[model samples]
Target: MNIVVIGAGLTGANAVEELRNQGYAGDITLIGAEPHLPYERPPLSKGLLLGTAEPGSVFAHDHDWYADHQVDLRLGSPVTELDLGRRRVGVTGTQIAYDRLLLATGASPRRLPLAEPSNPDVVYLRTLDDALRLRARLTGHILIIGAGWIGLEVAAAARQADATVTVVEAGSLPLLGVLGPELAPLFVGLHREHGVDLRLSTTVDSLTGTQVDLSDGTRIHADTVLVGIGAKPEDQLAAQAGLATDNGVLVDARLRTSDPHVCAAGDVANHDHPRLRRLRVEHWDNAIQQGKHAARTMLGDDTPYVRQPYFFTDQYDLGMEYVGHVGHAGYDEVVIRGDADTRVLTAFWIRDNEVRAGMHLNDWDAIDPIRSLVEQGTTDLDALRDPEAALPVPSG
Candidate 1:
């Protein structure tokens, strides 16, 4: 059997490894567009941006691991097209046949609209190469265009490196599009406490040299600009291959695409989550977990991906943790455990008297109980909010 995995990001890398672990003796080929081998992305904005990363520390697994598994690792080779009828992929100038194919093509950075002869000062942090360039340029007075997780994480690193950071958001609050307004203010306070100048409800007209002209008629001088507006999934291949796609390449609970032999995972997959019903999550944990699940499913294992959603971000000395799923209409009430102004607390999103989702700031200890409540579908909000209350024991 011949198996090929496209895109060498976290999802593709983990999927390849999981395939080998499941006792697959098939010929495996992993292809990546980027020159470097697979590496963790979470650190690219943090340690790599802050110049704290050690040498030879980024690969998900060492170089020897590939040789040990007898996997054909192809770097700098991108799959240009998928020929479903031929059961092959056109790469560079060659067509590679595959019994099974996994499309783990990750997302690309959201670029800003700038005129020709682009300014060299504008930076976007996404790949390892992007992080390396931004690390050298981010000395002082950095302007970030968006207030999402990527933008905010880079701001935190810049602040720690003693660089002046300013975050501009077009929305009324930062991260309102993802986490919603209920948990957005907590992040606003986090950045402010770390000495970051956060501008909310501001739109950028254009970038002229080091000055950012906003629609509000305000100009901010910046040494370097980093834009993290959002990411668009690379679903053109799946869609072009005649697979069902919506926002991302649509996949079932088994991670199988419209074509059973073709599968997808990671940020680019719009999976039918069993518990959440339908969700297109671009979370790191989801990518890793789903990639493993997809690989297992490909190997004839029928186990469903059952883990709940999880993601975390570090800002200054605080760690923000989020678990479970929360929809816009579900959260009828919110309960705050700690002070939001001071930025030391936990906010639980309650729907039908059950904890559907939660945001924690320096409150990691309280997460497990809340996660249990979400999983069990318990509707007792009053008891869940009180830390001292005994959790409802599960029956055997």
Candidate 2:
């Protein structure tokens, strides 16, 4: 059997590895648009931006691992066309035929409209090269236009590098969309405590020669501007191939696309999740788990991709691990254990008296039990909000 994976990111790399690990004696071709090996992207905004992590430490596998495993790894090859009828893909004047194909093409950072497009100081973080370039310019006054995870994380890194940092957000609080108005203030305090000049309920009106004009008739001078608004999935290849797409390539519970021979995972896949209905996740853990699951499905595994959603982030003294599917689910009440003022707590999102999701900040030991609570659909709010209350074990 011949398999071609059209991405070399974390998801694509894991798919190839799982295929080989499952003892599939087939021709596997892994193609990546970037010149570098498959590397983890979470570090790009944190450790890599702070210059604390080594360049090679983030790679999924070493360079020689591909050759030793008998996998054809192609770098710097972008698939320009996908021929579903011919069962082939066009990559820079070359054609490769495949019996099965997995599309792990990830996402790209959303670009903002700036008056000066030629300004070298304006940047966006997405890849290793982008991180490296941003790192080099982390010595001056840095202005970040967005209060999302990426924007806040880069602010943390910039502050750590002794750079004067400012974050501008149109919302009243940082991370308001993700964590809601109640919990978003915690992050607002976190950045403010770390000496970040956070301007809330504000927007960047224009950027002209390092002077950023704001919507509230104010201007801030900056040496470098990093835009972290959000990202859009790279699903053009799948859409062009006649695959069903809605925000991303639509896939079933098994990660199978519209065409049986084609599948998608990672950020590009809008999967029909078991508990969350249809959702598209753009996190590190989702990429790894979905990639492996997609590979297993290709190898005749019938198990549905039902792993609970998980993601984490580190900024200054705050380290958080969240597990749940609450992006769209409406939760009635939020239960909290410990003190939010102290910045060490475990919070649960409850809907219909059932725990839908939970997050731990500066508390590492609660993840497993918190995950168990969410999975078991615990409805005891009193016990959940009590730090001393024992968590119930899952019944077989």
Best candidate, TM-score: 2
lDDT of 2 by residue, 207-275 (tens): 987899999898999999999999999999998889999999999999999999999999999999887
Error of 2 at 152 (Å): 0.6
Cα misplacement distance, residue 238 of candidate 2 (Å): 1.0
Worst lDDT window (10 residues) for model 2? 387-396
Q: Give the per-residue lDDT of model 1 (tens digit) for 253-339.
A: 888899989888998888887877767777788879888888988887876676778888887787888878876566777777777
Off by over 4 Å in 1: 115-117, 390-396
Clashing pairs in 2: none
Q: Which TM-score value belongs to model 2? A: 0.97
Q: Pick the candidate with the highest lDDT.
A: 2
Q: Which ten contiguous residues of candidate 1 have the minimum total lDDT? A: 387-396
Clashing pairs in 1: none
